[model samples]
Structures are given as structure tokens and as C-alpha cells.
Target: MNWRIETKKTALLLIDLQDKLLSVIENRERVVQKAVQIVKLAKLFSLPLYISEQVPEKLGTTCKEILEVAGDVPRLSKNTFSASPILPADIPKNILVCGIETHICVRQTVYDLRMRDKTPYVLGDAIGSRNQIDHQLGIEEMRQDRVLITSVEAIAWEMIEKAEGAFFKEFLSILK
Candidate 1:
């Protein structure tokens, strides 16, 4: 399938990156940092942003940095691993998803998004889990279902397309 990263038709879904969950994941810093970058670029390109907290009362709120970067973007508190029900009904057709526990929340959300007929793109580098095995397995599972697995930089540049435009220059500065 031809996957075009169209910012206008995409919404960035930041799922279950809560503090408690993040602390247990390996390379938490790197993953969260990349997620932050994705969120920033989504904002820069005017893409809608949606974030889900997995039972926030128990798992705690999403990290302060992610929350801050998300700004007033719609935040959903969901007990379901799949974020679809919590997400807005009018969300865009394309979803760029990034977060922790790839085998659980990330995997289920991707499946759910596909079931709903929305194109789900998993930002590979921006997702993590406590165990690398489960993380890798989840990615493979998503790929088997034809979900696009990609890096934040790939999606960002694809959205910008050209290096000389206003968005491209700003995106370059962000990458730098």
C-alpha cells in the first residue's frame, strides 16, 4: 500500500506514556524524547493530537513533558487498552501512534484503529516496553497486519516533502 504522510489528514496519538509506566521501560528517555519531537512536529504542521491515559487514577498521569507539549489537545482517560472509544469520533482518517508498552497499549490501539478503518502508522523508535522482546514482537505483529511502522524523522520529512518551504525549514531546525 502507498502510505503518504499527510499532516492535514493525520492525528498524532500519544498513548499510555504515564510516568509509572515509562519508568519501567528500558531507554525511557530516548523513547519519550522522540515522542516529544513527534508531538512537536504534529503541532507545527497543524495535525490534530490525541492522548490517552490508561486509567490515570491508577497508572498516574502522562509525563509532564508530553502533557505540556500536547497542550490543550484532547486527552482521554481510558481503561480499555484500545484507545478508539476514548478518542474523538471525528478524529482524522490517518493516525500516527507513539507510546510505551508496545505489546499492550500500542499493539491493541493499532489493531483497533485498523478495525475502525483508519490508517494507523506506528512510530517505531518512539515506542518502548520493559522488555525488548515484547517490543519487537509487537512491531512485527503490527507489520504482519499491514500497519506501517516508521520513524519520527521519516514521517516528519514526508509531511514536509521539500526542504525549501516554510514548513520544511522549520522541520529541519527541529531535527537539528
Candidate 2:
């Protein structure tokens, strides 16, 4: 299958990256930092941003930094593991996914997206779980469903190919 990168046709879906959930994930800080970068790049490139909290009352809010970068993008609150059914139906095209508890929320969302015929790409480094085993298992599951698993830097650069120009320069600065 051909993997095409289209900024206008993509949305970044951040799943259950809340304080409670994040606290238990391994490499929490690193994961959040990478997710922040992804959010910044998404804003710079004009890609739509979608965030979900798995029952925010239980999981708490997504990190302040992430929420700040998210700006006006409405955050969806869901009791279900998959946010697809809750997300606005108008959001068409591929999704760039990142967040905590990869084996559960992440895997479920990817599966839902696949079932709905929407292309879902997991941002590998930007996702985390309570342990390494579950994280690896989540990625494997996503792969089995034919989801494109990739990294933030790779996806960002793919959206901004050339190393020069204003967009590229701004993107580089954000990455720094």
C-alpha cells in the first residue's frame, strides 16, 4: 500500500494523554514532549488537531502544554476505548495518533479507524503504555490491522519536505 502524506487531508488524534493516565506511563515526560512537538507541527502545517480524554472525570485533563497547543480544537470526552464514534463525523482523511495506554485506547482507536476505512498512522515515539510490553503489543496489534506506524520527526518532515523556506524554518525551530 502506498503511504501518502497530505497535510490538508490529515488530522492529529491525541488519545487519553491526560495527567492521570500519563503519570503511569513509562517515559511519560518524553512521550508528552514528543506529543507537544507533534501538536506544534500540526498547527504550523494547518492540519486539524483532535484530542480525547478517556472519561476526563476519571483520567483528568490532558497536560497543560498539550491543551495549550491544541488551542480551539475541541477535545472529545469518551467512555469507550475508541474515540472514532465520538469524534465529529465531518473529520475525513488520515489520522496521526499519539497518546498513553497504547494496548488499550491506542489499539482500539486504530482498530476502529481501520474498520471505518480511515487511514490511521501511529506516531510510535509519541505513544506510551504503563510498561514496555504493552506498548510493543499495541504497536504489533496496530501493525496487524495494517496501520502505518511511524515517528513524529518523520511525519513532520514528510509534511514539510524541503529544509528551506519559512514553513521548513519554523518547523525546524519548533523541533529544536
Candidate 3:
């Protein structure tokens, strides 16, 4: 498997990280921090971003932190557990996925993306579930299925490459 992340051909897919879910997800604060960090890098690289909500009327909109940095990115409103269908047809093949309910929305989306022949990278640190066991299980299931499971900093730095440029300095500030 080609583990190298090609930021030029990657789209960050944030699935169902809605306000309602965030309030209950385990390690909610850390998840938001990591997700926001990844969003910042996506903006830096001009990667396409695809966000979705699992019925915002019931679950509430995505967290303010995510939306604040998401810019004018479009949001797909869906009732289905899998978000793969909503991703734009023209996005690059590399899909960086994260968000709430790892056992449900996150897992389902990864499966669907694979069926569509897209390489789905599950950001381990940015994803969450209502419970730790379920979260671990979701990660295991996805990993067993050959999804490229990775952390936010690991993949982001791989995308960033050297740390001497203005872009690198901006990304470092995010850690502060």
C-alpha cells in the first residue's frame, strides 16, 4: 500500500461531527482540537473539504470550531449513516476522514468510500465515539478492512514536509 499522503490529491472528509454529537462524544475537546488543526492544514494546501451532518435538525449543526475554520465549504445534509455518496464527484482520490460516532457514521463512510475505489484515511486522533470500547472496535474493524488508519500530526506533517517555510510556521502556531 502507498502510505505516503499526497496532499495535492487529498480531500478532508469530516463526517457528522455535529454539535449534538460533540456534546456527548468521548474526548470531545481533543477531537475538536485535532479536527480544527487538520482543517487549518487543508486550508493551507487548498485541499477540497467535504462536510456532512446527520440530520442537523435533530443533531444540531457541526461544532462552531470546525465551521469557523471550514470557511465557505459546502455541507451535505443526509440521514444515511454513510457519507460517501455525498462527496463531490471531482475530489481527489485520497480521502482524509474523521468525526463522531466511530462505530456508526465514520465506519460506514469508510466502507462506502472503499467501494467507490477511493483511498480513505481515517484520522485516529480526530475521530470519536460515545464510548472508548466502541471507538477502539471501530478502529479495529476499519483497520482490518485495509483502511489507512493514521494520526492527525503524522499525516499533516507528512503533507507539510520540511518545517522551514511560512506554511510550516503557520502550522506550528496551531499547536500553541
Best by lDDT: 3
User: Could you list the CA RMSD of all candidates, in the order they appear?
Assistant: 1.4, 1.3, 1.3
Write model 2 residue lDDT over 1-176, tens digit each, in one string: 65668888899899989988888899999899999999999999888888998898876888898988888777899999888888778776789999878899888888888788788889999999999999998899778867789999888878886888887789889989
Model 1 error, position 44 (Å): 0.5
Model 1, global lDDT: 0.88
lDDT of 2: 0.88
Quote model 2's TM-score.
0.94
Give, for candidate 3, the lowest lDDT window spanning 10 residues.
167-176
lDDT of each: 0.88, 0.88, 0.89
Q: Residue 81, candidate 3: how far off, in angstroms?
A: 0.3
Question: How close is every model to the real structure, measured as TM-score?
Answer: 0.94, 0.94, 0.95
Across 49-137, the per-residue lDDT of candidate 1 in tens digits comes to: 88889999998998998888788766789999888888877889999999978999999999988888899989999999999999999
Lowest lDDT 10-residue stretch of candidate 2 = 1-10
Alpha carbon deviation, residue 105, candidate 3 (Å): 0.5
